[model samples]
Target chain A: MKRVLIAAALSTTALTATSAAAQTEIEFWHDKTGRLGELLKEQVATFNGMQSDYVVVESQKGNYSEVLNAGIAAFRAGEQPDILLVFEVGTATMMAAEGAIKPVYEVMAEAGADFDADGFIGAVKGYYTTNDGQMLSMPYNSSTPVLWVNRDKLQEAGINPDVDLSTWQNVGDVLDQLKAAGVDCPMTTAWQSWVHLENLSAYHDVPFATKENGFSGTDTELAFNGPVQVQHISTMGEWARDGKFIYAGRRNEGGANFRGGDCALFTESSAGYAGINAEAKFEFEVRPLPYWEGVDGAPMNTIIGGASLWVLAGQTDEEYKGVAEFLNFLSSPEIQAKWHQDTGYLPITSAAGDLTREQGFYDENPGTDIAVIQMTANQPTANSKGLRLGSFDQIRGIIDEELEAVWSGDKTAQAALDSAAERGNALLRRFEQATR
Target chain B: MEKRVRFKGLWLPLLLVMPQLLITAVFFFYPAGQAIWQSLFIPDPFGLSMRYVGLGNFEFLLSDPFYRASFVTTAVFSILVTLVSMGVALYLAVLADRLIKGSGTYRTLLIWPYAVAPAVAGVLWLFMFNTRVGVVTWYLGVLGYDWNHVLNQGEAMGLVVVASAWGRISYNFLFFLAGLQAIPRSVIEAAAIDGARFWTRFRTIVFPLLSPTTFFLLVVNIVYAFFETFGVIHTITSGGPQQATTILVYKVYADGFVGQDLGSSAAQSVILLVIVGILTIIQFKYIERRVHY
Candidate 1:
């Protein structure tokens, strides 16, 4: 009689808890921490408040690599969250994971969610799409590299505030002038290899790899150590030797140096916007990443840097419906516009950009629109759609090492490039064989 | 006679040792077995690729010039850091042992660094070593050290070795200090009474007594230099300036996690294991055998 009473009480408690929870909780895993983290929480609250059946619970994973690693581990363990934020580079890897991910288009169509692929910026959209434009992921926090200038430091060095440095040639003169005027640090770059090599390749309309920079196929070869690449790297090496371009450690160790107002010019991702905006006491401006004027087809559009939200496979129809609805809510113009304005990430859609413009947010913040402009200014060639090689993250490390060698005067540009290409291509071939 | 008979009995021995034996086989041998197996197979990032080619990863590593170069660098790094740290730790431990006043405080303070997490230590070292805003860099500039790890290969290696030693020295010092305390004062007093000076007493008496500790430290420090230094190195130099300090473990991480060449990375790990195994065997067979204690 006592055991039956206990069982009845337990059932009553479970029923009450279920009634309290009424809504289905969908899990969201992202790499945002601190301010961006807070913004996401706010967004989640807004969505939950608007809905009666779904509650999106957001979790803060670690930085980009940690988040990616966590997601991959979770997927393997069959405990992956409903939505996973995979970086832009990992899009290829995620796409190629046969049944691991359900493309966003399928989910949207199945749930009849309101989404227009045509509303997204072409280049930003292209990075996350197949050649025929089946959107695989939703581009979130899209940013391209740009030149961040400390105008106060430039002024301190007696340089004109309006000095044009749209090209590397002009920047070289500015660097020399800053040096002559005893500027301790004239120019420093973040993601030294990425900003200097990868974007430089795109800016010069050169391919970073063969086979459409690995977008079309697996058997791709690195073409980064080519002549144009060599010249740019050698020039940076000369700058490092000259004390103009300081060799900071990898992983944005120089961000602090730049942030401290010790450096005049910084080449960093547009995603650095939030950090820079918060820290910089001086007047700062964003300009297009300078290209070498001598190169033909110079000043080509830059590619995106931040991650996108990939819809994972192996979910019930209701879960898929939840994902579609959540994504549709995330893509609404009001939400996207606010996200773009708040985080300084590019508004992923034209409608979002138009909303921001109509609201005069762009007028209030001038260079906030530069990332969008840089990414959307041109029609993306196969080469410029962005890299999708199987082992790109590893290849980036090799390029980083080779770039370091150049900076330290250990190797000339051609030597570093040749060796990197040789070594990197070996890995590619091995990757190709292994993947095959 | 009864204990000897029990030791000789298989059932008795097996019952006593089964847990530890099983644990070792399950954990250590299993990982070793898996690493060996993985070295034979290649892994692709996507689930698309899983191919086995016998001895392919090993041959590829052997032929690769970059791996060869980093292997030698790893050797140089491991040896230099182990020796320097052991020497410094021994000296400090001896000095602390001899101090009459505030000895406990000194010992406690010295062990404080050992309590710090390795990840935290890496961050602190990076902050101190940073070129522009680093306090140490400014002081070095004032003192004419010409030190900049990011731009110079030698300096980068120096920074890595120093940071590795700094992170590891406290634990080593603790061991040596404990070993120092274990020695009886009467033996050293006898040496002194025999008109033996400090240097002679240290060399003939104290050094022999500390042999076991030194041997233990040699093996431990070398392993620490190989595995633990990678994080701090990655934080500070990132095997940079010119790939000057990219050691074996850093290469493993870069290849396996970042590069996604799990098979080749396993091959590198296998090679590292073999190299460490050979070194450990040599130490046991030769150096430790010759030690007095």
Candidate 2:
């Protein structure tokens, strides 16, 4: 009798929930935190207020790597959400999960949402799209590497605050001056492999790996140990030995050092603006990523970092439609412009960039549009397009270890990169064979 | 002499042990069996297709230089952790056991570190040694000693070992304190009356009787260092400075979750299982022989 009454009560609650609002529930899992998380929540609230057909429930699931791992584990258990935000490095892993994800193009078309593939900036879209130019995921918080200058530190080090750091040569001279002026850490970097190697290759129009950085096929091999990369690494190694370049941990551990006013120069993601702007007491400025002046066609645009939103497969039609509508709302120019302004992420569409410019945001906040201009300034070459390789995340780990050897003076720049390339190639071959 | 009792009905005895048997089969045996099976085959991310290659993954790992280096690292780490944690724990337990009135308070205070999670312990140690803002690092710097674990292999390994061992000391301390209390006080008192010093009494009388607990803790601490310290390594070093602290378990995680290579990870796990099995067998054999001494 008790079980019968419990079942009746549960059924009554369920009926009331459905009858009051027949809202299709879409679970959107992400890894944004702090101000970015608040902004995402605000967007969700706005969407929910705009219409009542669908209620998007957003959940913060750990950091970037944790979220991807959780999404995969959930999919294997057949309990994945309708949408997942995956970091850029996990693009290959997500793409290889056949039948586990629904391409955004198909979701948009099925839902009849107005999504123009051409509206997205080419360089940003190229990273997540197929060979046939189909976008597999929506680029959500794209960022590129840039030089972060602490004006106070530079001035305190007896260097001109308005000095040009547009070239690596000029930056090296300034670093020497800062070191001579008794600055402890003249320069530090976050995401060493990303800023120093990956973006360095792209900014100089060189291939980080073969087969167009693994976009053509799975048989790609590492080519980042070339002369241009070696030169840059050897220079950094010299700086490290001279106590000018401090080697922080692999990821964004140096962000703390830079924000704490201990470092004079930091090469980090443009999304660093949100943090530096918030925590940095000294006057700091975002400058264009430095390039090697010796190389021809140098200072090319950089590739995107950050993450994108992928629509997972196996949800119902109505649920997928809800996901599509949400993404479409997120892609609208007004929302994109606001997200770009708020988070310092790249405006995904040219329209958003133009809108922000028309609103005089660029004039109000100088150097705010540098990332957008950097990404859209040039047609990305075959080498500068982006890397989409299997086992890339692991390969990055190998590269980080080898680079640390150089920083410690245990190995030469060429030797470290060479060893790193060799070790990375073995993993690539294993990945190729595994996915074959 | 050994005494044994036999139940009247076999079915009743089997029924009595059914729950234990069922749990073992579900949790332990099932996963072990799956890992063994998966080691022989490589599956895609979606598990849509699997290619059977018996012993292929094992062969690859055997040839990998980094995998072999991790073995040496794991051995060094496990030994250091066991020795440091147990040695410190034994010393603390002996001290607490000597106290007549405040023994309970000392025991309670010593066991507090056991409550800290391994990851939290690692983060605490990391902050203290962080190159940028660490108070300890800054003090070391002032004393003309540069402490940068990011580039120094030995420092990285040292940091992980200390962090891992710090969390295990409380558990070992609890067991050691209990074992000390269990020893007959009259035996030590009689030795003391005979003009034996404290160290002599502890060495000659107290140490021999506490051998059982010591052996037990050695085995437990070794296993804890092996399988349970991945969180410490992950939070602290992440197996860096050229894989200085990448133990077998850490490698399994790095390859499986970070690299998305399940087959190799499973193969590594199977290898780790065999190592643990041998270690456990050896430990139990030693314990059996020492328990009678």
Candidate 3:
């Protein structure tokens, strides 16, 4: 009798759920996993519970590349989700996909959703905006590269744990000291191309590509082979030869070494805090990414890494309204603040950052504000705004290969960067022609 | 009288072969035709816009130094994987055949690695050679020889080759063991009675009778190394360390799925198809001539 009652209860719930078909379902496909995935699902549930007209469903589509590919494939088949999470490098590809996506601003205007374009932080907003200041996509889960120091390892190397690593010169001196003190891995890095070449060009206020890093037009060529980038890579190469810097794999393979207390320093995404804080047995600190002192506008700003939510085209009016409402919910101060605290991603809006500070979250967790400060410290110049090149994912593969050549001593920095630029420009030309 | 069975009517024979023909058309010919068609044009990411280039992609790829270099790399990788896997399997099969006791258990143990997927096998090997926490890397460090496959080209190639071959050894071993067991005992006994040594008898008698199996495995293993080892390379090296391990198939995946350049990827697949076709033809026409069966 109890089993029959349970089955009857389930049947009733299913019937009620079918009867409430008035709730327009909004499908959101993203690439977040682990704690972040859970938090995203929680936000979706909260949004669903807070309203009667909309029910948001979330799905994981593997990593960033997989998500983009899946989105494209689905779009081709006329079965696309309401929203897609595309990484920053794919901005150009998404933008050129003319009829495949609906701009976020248009969605807001059509649905009469509350959206203040100016409320978003300048650096983060500028990445996904056009020259006429139109937002293309909703910014979400953005982060910048920073320096992570293993405090225990520093002290063991006879160096002060509080030593300032603001400048590359000071970091070099500390690396020498750590090497002399018998440390095997003085420094290591993840996302070598991002932290070394792309971010280095932006932070030093040098162009990574011509035509304002491809924001102005698609006919741009790579300019990262310039003197500034070459010098930075050359220094890293020298350090690799000196045993002061250890070369890891192309991606975040060094995170394991650093978290295991085998490396003294790691240059990785600020979002790495979510993993490092939970796994590290030793104390660690986050610092602003170092810059060279001699550059004219050194330490200007670091661009964001991580993905943003883009509204896809060809959805019903009701579904679009649901999507717009969900996006608005995501941008609210409480939700954004909680997300920023839970993950190390930057809060998209100034109101969210202010709310976190007012709640004393940053005070309780020191160094949590470094990414925001570094991003908003200066008005982003044309060079520092962000890269928006076509086929940038492939271009980054070329850059990774060239960078590996430099690290392995197979080629000098200048030669490798030159080859990378030449190869990357070929893909850029192909992109331009195909889009045209 | 002829031993071959004769069909009564044309319609019956056609109906009997319809399922296989349908399956082949859907699975093989359709995709191959689509790849050829797509290779002639460049399609945008959404596939809504397609511009005809008329062999432009092939021209560009033929001129690319990196693509040309990958051809050489694939040649070296497939050759090494085929030789190593086949050689080791043959040696193990010979040893297992010589065992009088517990041979069944030995054969079962030798066949276990065939159960592992290519990607899983790659990860297992990667964990052992990882620079930071790898047990073998640590041991090598203690022995005063550092093993950093991430940076070393030769080491990267060697590691991927071994990892690709490790999973294939089980498959080859099973075939070799069956082929060895099928050899008639009377011939070996007669040779032994004539005062012939074990090495001479095996080389002259057993090897000749095993030629059919050997030739078949040669063709299959070569094809396996060329096509199916992509998972192993992708999981282990991702065609890295300056594209040292970038086999043709891995390049096809990187360009098509990851890079989103469908036209170039299609063109590459067509080229790979032609290469494999030529390889199979050469093997059948030349290598099969030496087999007695």
Candidate 4:
């Protein structure tokens, strides 16, 4: 009789636990920490409060590459989350994993959620879309490279803080003056390959790779060793030799130097504004990225960096419905505008941009709209639409090595770029084979 | 007379050793077999499909100049790390053994670094040597010396090597100290009464007595330098400035995890395993002859 009573009690407890969890749970794994992480949690709480049928549980994985690796491993083990945030470079890898992901368009359509494909900015949307205009991932925090200026440093060098630096020629003059004035670090850049090679080709309206930068097919060849690219790299190499340019690292290690008021000029992502605003003690300004004056159709459009949200496969239908709803909530104009104003990431949708402008965010923060204007100044050419190539992360490593050789005066610009192209092409061919 | 305990039956002996055999099979053999099998094929990102390439992965790696250069880099790195770490540990152990008072405090302070994880050790070193904001870099600048390891291959390699060897000295010190304490003191006292100085006595008596510990440490340190030290290389240099410090193990991690090229990484591990096997055989065959025990 006592055993029967204990079994009944256990059954009652299990039933209550199941009943309390009636809301369908959707798991979201992202690579954000600190302030961004806290903001994401707040957004999730607001969403859960507004709804009754679903709850989104968000988790912070490691950095970009780590998150991609973890997602792939989880998929293989049949334990993947419902949503993952993959970096821009991993687009090709994710797209190739057909059965591993559920495209955002299909998820939105099947769930009948309010998603507008046309609402997104062209350059931002084009990066994560198929050739047929179907969206693959939900565009999130997109950012473009811009030039950051230390106004006090410029003034200390007896130069105007508002000097025109629209052209590389003008920037070169400034660099020479800064060097002459005994500035140790006149100019330094983060994301060397992205800013100097990939986006430089896009801004100059030249091909970075064949087959429309790998949008049409997988058999694309690297063309970044062209004369224009070589000329640009040669100029930078000369600057390095003269101590006018500092190469801190392959990634954003230069951010600290720039924020510490050591560098007069910095070329970094627009997303750097958050950290610089928080840490920099001196006044600073944001300016459009400079382009060479001689190139035709120059300063065309810069490509996007940062990441997007991708829905994974193998979740229950109810879970996918919750994912679609949460994504819709995130892309709403109020939410997106708030995120853009808080984090300095691009407002991905037109409505969000308009809402931000109407709310006086751009007026209050001068020079913050440079990235948007730079990206939307002209229709993106075939080259400016951004890259879609497999093994891009590895190719970037090769580029970094070659660029370092040039910076250290071990190799000429043309020689280093040629070698980089050769090595990068070999990897591309290997990727082509592996996917085939 | 020799005393031995004999098992009653084969079943009892086999049963007694079953747990160890099972653990070895599960932990070592299973993963090794997986690596060997996976080395022959390239799988898709989702692992939904695998394409067999036979010896193609090996062929690619062998032909790649970067991969070939890593072999030399790994050799140089392992040799330098083993020599520096072991040499320093032996010297410190000798000093500590000679201490008549406060030896325990000195020994405890020396052993503290061994408790730090390799990655944490790497981060600490990186902070002190950071180019833009490092304290050491600032001090060097005040002395009219410029230090930028990001673009300097030699400096990057030196920094990573020093950091890798720094944490390992404590581990080697423990063994050397134990070996020194185990040595009988009567022989040394006799040598002293015979008018032998400290250096002469150490060279003729104590040095030979510590040969077994040195030999054991030599083998272990080589293995440690080869397979471990990935964290230090990763955090400090990341195999950068033209792949100057791209050791073999770091390459395995970069390719397999970051690059998602599993087949090549697996093939490289197989080659590494074979190389280590050959090295162990050589050490046992030739180097063992000089060891006293």
Specify the poorest-scoring 10-residue window by lDDT in model 4 chain B: B1-10
Q: What is the TM-score of each candidate against the true structure?
A: 0.94, 0.96, 0.97, 0.96
A192-298 per-residue lDDT for model 3 (tens digits)? 98999999999999999999999999999999999999999999999998999999898999999899998999999999999999999999999999999999998
Task: Report, for candidate 1, the interface RMSD.
Answer: 2.1
Find the candidate with the highest DockQ and give its number: 3
Q: Highest TM-score: which candidate?
A: 3
In terms of lDDT, the best-performing candidate is: 3
Which candidate, 2 or 3, would have the higher lDDT against the true structure? 3
lDDT of model 4, residue A382: 94
List model 2 lDDT by residue over B1-293, tens digit each.
56798679789889999999999999989999999999998777667568898999999899989889999999999999999999999998888877899877887888899999999999999999998888999999999999999899999989998999997888998998999899988998899999999889988988889998999898899999999999899999999987888999999999998887899999999999999999999988766686733
**Over 4 Å off in model 4, which ranges?**
A1-20, B1-13, B193-196
Q: Regarding DockQ, does 1 or 4 come out ahead?
A: 4
Docking quality (DockQ) for each candidate: 0.60, 0.71, 0.83, 0.79
Tens-digit lDDT track of model 4 for A295-378: 988979999998999999999888889999999999999999998898889999999999999999999999888898999889
What would the per-residue lDDT of candidate 1 be over residues A94-137, giving only the tens digit for each residue?
77776778899888999988779999888888888887789999
Q: How many residue pairs clash in each candidate?
A: 0, 0, 0, 0
Q: Kindly report the root-mean-square deviation of model 3 from the true structure over all alpha carbons.
A: 3.2
Across all candidates, what is each one's fraction of true contacts kept?
A: 0.64, 0.72, 0.77, 0.79
10 residues in a row with least lDDT, candidate 2 chain A: A1-10
Off by over 4 Å in 3: A1-18, B1-9
Which whole-number lDDT from 0 to 100 does residue B215 have in model 2?
A: 90
User: What does candidate 4's lDDT look like per residue over B135-165, in tens digits?
Assistant: 9999999999899899999889888888999
Question: What is the DockQ score, from 0 to 1, of model 1?
Answer: 0.60
